[model samples]
Target: MKTLVVYYSLEGNTKEAAEKIASSIGSDIMELVPVKDIPKKGLMKFIHGGSGATMGKGTELQPYTKDASSYDAIVIGTPVWAGKPCTALNQFLSDLSSTEKVIGAFAFAGGSADKCLSFLREKYPSIKYTVSLADRNSKKLAPENGSKLSAFIEELKSELISN
Candidate 1:
């Protein structure tokens, strides 16, 4: 199956995880970039991002070449903000053109991602798999989270085979 990993990252944690997953599964990857991004540093980052996430706002994204409908499966990744997905990721999900393909997601958070993951599942009912990773604000992969990611990749592989 042709799988694509789509994600948006503000602090690189989600990017690192997305890269690892794409490399492990040998799938294509696409990064979602917002046209107008929130401040990356300072108190305003929290204020703006948290408010947007709390309101479930979706931002405008830069033009992307990948057509999600062409893939058999899609694995989305995002950083959890205010217990919800980041604005860029929300935009990507909202713009997704296909619903028949298998879907999966991964979330990065400072603490537990239970709420974010649940929110994703509820909003996107087609998602068949999910994994959460601790956002340590570093490029280095955590050992425990690595294992969880591996398990997620395996499940995705199995799902692809079944389909």
Candidate 2:
């Protein structure tokens, strides 16, 4: 089955996890980029990003070349921002046509991914698998987490095959 992994990352944590998930599942990957860039550091980033996520705002993104409809499944990865997915990913999900496709989600955070995962579940009822990682920063995942990612990929494969 063909699967795709799409994500938006600001601190590189989400990007690290997305890449690993894609590699494990042998899926195509897409990174969402916003037309307007968010500041990477300082209080402004925290204020803007947190407010945007808390308010469920959507940002304009650079045109994505890949059509999500072409994939049988899509795994979305994100880092928790003010307890929800970032603005870029929020826009992507809002604009996505996920009809007849299996959805999966993974979230990373310094403390918790509960809010992010919950938000995704509500938004996409098709999500069949989910993973949450805590305290992951802008670095590659550890070997143990890599094993867990491999297991997640296996579960996705199993679910798709059964369906």
lDDT of each: 0.86, 0.81
Give the number of the best model, judged by TM-score: 1
Tens digits of per-residue lDDT for model 2 on 6-79?
99988887898888878866789999999986899898988988999999999999999689888888888887
- Writing each residue's lDDT as its tens digit, candidate 1 over 74-137 gives 9999898999999988888778777546389999988877789999888788898999888775
Instruction: Give the worst 10-residue stretch by lDDT in candidate 2.
Output: 135-144
TM-score of 2: 0.88
Candidate 2 achieves a global lDDT of 0.81
Candidate 1 local distance difference test against the native: 0.86
